[model samples]
Each structure stands twice: as structure tokens, then as C-alpha cells.
Target: MSDSEETYKSIAVLGIGTVAAPLIEAGLLANNASVLVITRPSPKARQIPEGAHHAAIDYTDVSALTAAFRKHSVEVVVSTVNHEALDVQPAVAEAAKKAGVKLFVPSEYGLPSAGHTEGVLLVKSRFVDSLVAAGLPYARLYVGGFIEWIPYLFAINETGKFNIIGEGKAPATFTAISDIAGFLAYVLTHLPPSQLHNVSFRIQGERKTPRELAALYGDKAPLVEISEFPPSVKDGAFRKFLQVAFNAGFASTGYDAAEGKDDEKRAGSSNSLWPGHQWKTVKEVLNL
Candidate 1:
């Protein structure tokens, strides 16, 4: 089959949150793919996008999820479930398997988590294990960090004071949310099963140090070196851990020396997978 030919005609997006929104609009729906947004039965109404189907199922019930997948003839299952709720993915994988789904894309749009032992990374790793155990073909996407969340990740407050975690010298990968969604939809529709199955696509739109990132804002954002994260921060402990990981260089698309030479060597950024597309940079996105 030609690369331009759509391999998966029916695509089911598991959530309608931050990531799923663009994936449905610019990515899947724009490409003219049959898109289905799957959400848990909610009392509140959801504004599902036009040109897409919506299925409200009890996510905890594997049989119900399986029926929904089968009813829509879903070929690919793209999960955008929040990291905290990733424990529910194993059951989702079971349903996908039972429904004979072609591919399973888990909710792993963050820093590399191959050998993580604790925190949400560990939870994501376990979900991949479940996919393997269930014998389901899967694709894992690692984009380091979303460009839209840079202010929050960098702890840059309203007054433009940037918190310098560690030395703020470690380089980290950043991709615009639109690029992440666009790239995902492109590859899923264009690439064949041999290239898509059980593979990790490490992509980055831009790479920059925290200091450099702050510098992009010029005099508007001043850097403040801090020994610890502020107490007022929401999810302070988790966010602090992520900052530490970024400082240790785990937040880059490329392999870091701190990870040890003996560690499993990861492939370099797969940004070329989507050839000829101009990737959005931090400066461009922030208008800096």
C-alpha cells in the first residue's frame, strides 16, 4: 500500500481532553478519517467536535468498551486518558483485544519512561506491559514536554519571574500540542502496520535549556534561582520530581549520559518521520 493511503479508516480517540481535542479537529477529522470520541458516561454534557462520533461507556466495564469498539468497527484506539488514571488502561487494552482492534496507542505524551521505577512514569510503563501481555500491537509517542505547558513546567508566574530549577542548563525537548497531534494522526493514517506496531516514536519540535528558554522572553521574564519548589504549586511533589528529572536530562528526546552508557540505547528524535512539515518552536509559539 502507498504511504499516502489511509491504513486505519476508523479511529477511536479514548478521551476528549487537552490532547484529544486537536487530534480530533486538525488531525483525524481534518484528514477525513472516521473519528470516534469515547468518554465515560457523564452527567455533564461534553462538546464533542463535529464530524466525529461519541460513545459514552463505563470505562471500568471491559465488556461495554469492547461492544462499543466492535459497534464502530474501530481500527485504531488512541488513548488520551490523564496519567493519574492510566491504571484503567490495562482493562481498556483487554477490551481492544477482545474487539480485535488493529492498534492501541496509550496515553504516554510526556518524558521518557522506559526504566522509570516510581511515579506516573512507572504507571505508564505498566500499561505498556499490559498491552504486550495481551498481544496487542501498540505505538508509544514521547514528545518530552508540550510547548503550551512551558510556563507551568518552567514555573514562570504572571509577573514573568522564571524559577530556575537546578542549574537550568539541561536541554529538554518541547513540541507544540498541535504538532504532536498532527504528527500522530499523520503516521497512524500513512504508515503501515510493520512500521507502526510496537514502536516508540521520539519526536521533538525544539530543544533548549531552561536558562535559554527563559532568555527567549528577553527582559520580560527574569530568572530566579530557587533551592526548592514553591509550596503554593499545585501537584507540588510531582511537579518538583519532573523538574528534577528535567535537570538530570531525562526530559530530552536524545539519550542522556546520566542514564548510563549500559542503559538501553534509545533511538534519536523521529521528527523526520513527518517530513517537510515546519515544526513550531518555543520562540514562535510564545511570540518571543
Candidate 2:
């Protein structure tokens, strides 16, 4: 696909916090996409990245957000705010619809929310629903687990004390925040007629088992297996424990670095943003 900066002009990044801030920064660097940041009117507003338009926003008021979108003439809306997705996401969708924002990217930066069955309505899912219901042009990148959260949560790099269950060897999905934004930039710039889609474009840097990772660094650090119960009796089970976590939302999984279709097309993209652009590896991200 032809990835030309002319495709995206004014872009609004909702909640310039955490990974989204850097993602927007990276996009602004490589491409000429002008960024519009939506931030709460607070002392923290200064944290929004430079080289873009910034607006103080209160997510609780959809009308106010709608005004920001219209005032900025935002062509694309990207939501990056986390934790409060239930309230913020739906509000963003509503405001975008009212303001006639052409494209919307929800806060789903991981597994496909489409497969979850028991959700009365997770925050992200609710915002996703608003996107569908609003009929706003939307796309999501499903780049598996965030490697940043793994080591601490699993106590990797050291082993004596960890919450690891089952053979960590089961291949799992993961995507660095940087990579996710790169791929997401590609999609938002090249979304098709499916205004909404059930399929998620997945990616990952590595998929080694706990045993493999343990073996690699276990001798160098303290590694302790957390559970020894039978798979049937375990809370999430083993053998395919990682897969279950992804499915059940206990741990991140659901996608891997498998050989398949190119990363450019989610539903259909005539011009891909990162066709030949080589992406960073998990190894490189780890080192960084």
C-alpha cells in the first residue's frame, strides 16, 4: 500500500498518557501527521508531547469533547487513555460521531475484544461498542501482550519468587508499545469500508515457554515455579496455560509471530503505512 502523509492530516490523540504519547510521537516523527492531543485541564497537561496541537478535555462531558474535535478539524481520533476506558472510550466515540470525525481508534491495543463472551461489558469493549453503534470509521490493532508488564508480573529476570503457573513454554502473543503504534499508524491511515471488524491484526516479538525463558536466565537469577497442581485442578490450567489466560483475560495471549498475511491489511488497505518498513524485534525492544 502507498503510505503517504497526505492521507492523514489533523489527528487527535485522546489521553496522551503512557504508551499513546510515545506512539503519537513516533508517528509524528516518521510521518507528517499533525497531532491533536486531548488532555484534561490539569497541571499535568504539560506532559503532552510537543509538535502537536493540544486541547484540555473533560471526558465526562461528551459535548465538550465534540467541540474539541470540531474546533481542531480532526480527521482521525486515536484513544490511548487507559484504566477508565469504560467512561472515557464511549464518550470519545459519541463526541467523534457528533463532530463528524472520520476515523476513530479505540483503546484496544491488545487481543481482539470480539472473542470475549462473558463480558457484561469491559470498559474497552463498551467504547468499542460505541464505535460500532456510532457508525464511525474505526480500526484496532491486536498486538498481543505488553512485554513491559511481563517481567514484573511474572518476576522474570529473577525466578525465586514468581506467579508463574504451568510450563511457561507455551507460545504466547506480545507486542511492544512502540511496535503497536507503528502498526496502528499503518491501519488508521489505511482503513477500509468495514467501519467495524471482528478480525484483529496480531503481532508479537517472542513466544517462548516459561521453561525456555527460565532456562535462558534461570541460572543467572532466582527462579521458582509457583504451582505444581495438576492441570485439571489449576485455576487456569497448564500445558496451554498462556492461551487460556489470553482467552480468559487473566494473562495476555491470543496472537503470535506466525507466518501468514502481511501486516498491512487488517480488512483492506490500498496503501499500507509500513509495507517495507522493518519493525523492531522483541530482542531489540528488550535491550532498549
Candidate 3:
């Protein structure tokens, strides 16, 4: 790609839920990039942002998806589809490759998928393999858990009460949804494809245990431990395993003290990489 084609002037997004919403907002903020979303056909009318574009395509049909990407001249494909729609990622990757998309951003904003037994992680790993095999340029953002989801996952109730599944001292990596979205937008538009490809772009807002987080909330909220809630590996046991997994340090934890600074710098894929931005820690977010 030459200087004329090096920039990602147009982007295609795959979903429009919580994660995708902020991404789309960031895209619209970009000076030269045009945003387009591939939405599923709905019987009722659907709402879309004013400046951003939309295309209803059968994600099952790879050829149709390819045509849509080519028609829009989408340089980067940012997929923010939910876990339930993960099956369509390979097809999306294949279509992006066929359409000559410069970069493909897969929906992998969570824990590292290298050696996890969790079903969701396995699915993510497989999709990443497909991208590598297809020779597509891609960026994987391993943002651990979203801070916004903490309340719902920890069984927090409307009265500002919550429960920890086990001992409340397990530290987990968490990033605010807004920060993740902003970083994605920045990388897709500013970073060159050569640098963005095959990169594990990570950013975490806070790395704290549940007990620490509860303490930050102070008297306004109380935390309880529900020891009876056993971890399970059934179909929808992601949260259960997540609690135990973080407790066991299953996610990528930079390096040991003996490993030295080089490894620590590599492992600490953090917000410091991006300038002029303030990442919110638990204390900052909870007003502790």
C-alpha cells in the first residue's frame, strides 16, 4: 500500500450493541474515516446513527459479505459482535480477505486465549487461527473483563449490593468500555496495517480483587461471599469459571520479579502506550 492507500479511510463494523456502540461513536469522531455497520435483517425498524452507514447482509453468505465490503471500500473491518454470534467471525475474516481489507479487528476483547479451557476462549482461539491461516491482517485486543460488566457478573442487585463467588481476593484485569472503544478507533485509523497486524493490543483500567473494589464503594454498597455457588463447566458457566480463573492467575500476568523489565514491558500492554488519555482505576470510578 502506498502513502495514498496507507490510511484507513473507511471502516466496517459488525454489531451495534454495548461494545460496538462506543466503537461506532469513536469512528464517527475520526476526521477522515467513514463508518459502516453490517446488520442482520430485522422485521421491525432499527435505529442507526446519523453519519454512520448500515448494510443488512446474511452473515452466513461469505460472498455477500465480501461484496458488501468491496462495495463500501472498507479498509478495516472491526467486529464487535456478541459471543452468541461468534460463529460468523470466520466467514467475516474470509470475506475481508477476499475484499482486500487492510486490517481485520476480531471480537477478542477479553483474556488471552492461548491455553484456556473455557468454551468462549476456545471459540476465540479458533477464530484467531482462521484469521492467521487466511493471511489476513488483524489486531486482537485482549482487554480482560469490561468494568461495566462487573456489577452484572458479580450478581450485584439494584440496591447496590453484591456477592463474590469465592474468596474476594482474586485480582482481575478490567478496562472501561469507553477506553477500549477509543483505543480501537485510534489504532484502526492511526496505526499502519503492518504494525497493527497480529498484535495483542491490550489495555486495562484496573487490576484489583473484588474485595478491594467493594471497599472502594464504601458504605454505599456491601459485598458478600456466596461460597455455596460452585463453579461449573456447563454451556453458560463463563462467569463461574472467570471468577476461579482470575483467582488462579490464569489470564496473562506480565512476568515474575525475576523476569526483568523487558518481559514486564511486553506483558504490561497498558494505556501508557497511548498518550493524552486518563484511564480510570476502580478507586477513581467508584469515588473511593
- Stretches of candidate 2 off by over 4 Å are 1-6, 119-123, 157-162, 190-199, 227-273
- Residue 135 lDDT (model 3): 82
For model 3 the local lDDT of residue 231 reads: 40
| Displacement of the residue 152 alpha carbon in candidate 3, Å | 1.0
Please identify which of the two predictions, 1 or 2, would achieve the higher TM-score against the true structure: 1
Clashes, model 1: 0
Q: What is the C-alpha lDDT of each candidate?
A: 0.83, 0.59, 0.72
Ranking by lDDT: 1, 3, 2
TM-score of 1: 0.93
Clashes of each: 0, 12, 0
Quote the positional error of residue 145 for candidate 3 in Å: 1.4
What overall lDDT, based on C-alpha atoms, would model 2 receive against the true structure?
Answer: 0.59
**lDDT tens string, model 1, 156-239?**
764367777688887888899999999999988778788899988988888888888888876777888877677776765666
Compared with the true structure, model 3 gives a TM-score of 0.86
lDDT of 2 at 7: 61
**Candidate 3 segments whose C-alpha is farther than 4 A from its true place:** 1-5, 158-160, 228-236, 251-268, 283-288
**For candidate 3, lDDT tens digit of each residue in 1-288?**
678547577899898878788788754445557988888887867567768888988777899999999999988898888888899888888889999997888888777665444588778877877788888877888776778777666655443666666786756677788888887777777766667878777677777777877777666668867654434412225666677665554443342223321132444465665678888776655445
- Cα-based TM-score, every candidate: 0.93, 0.75, 0.86
Better of 2 and 3 by TM-score: 3
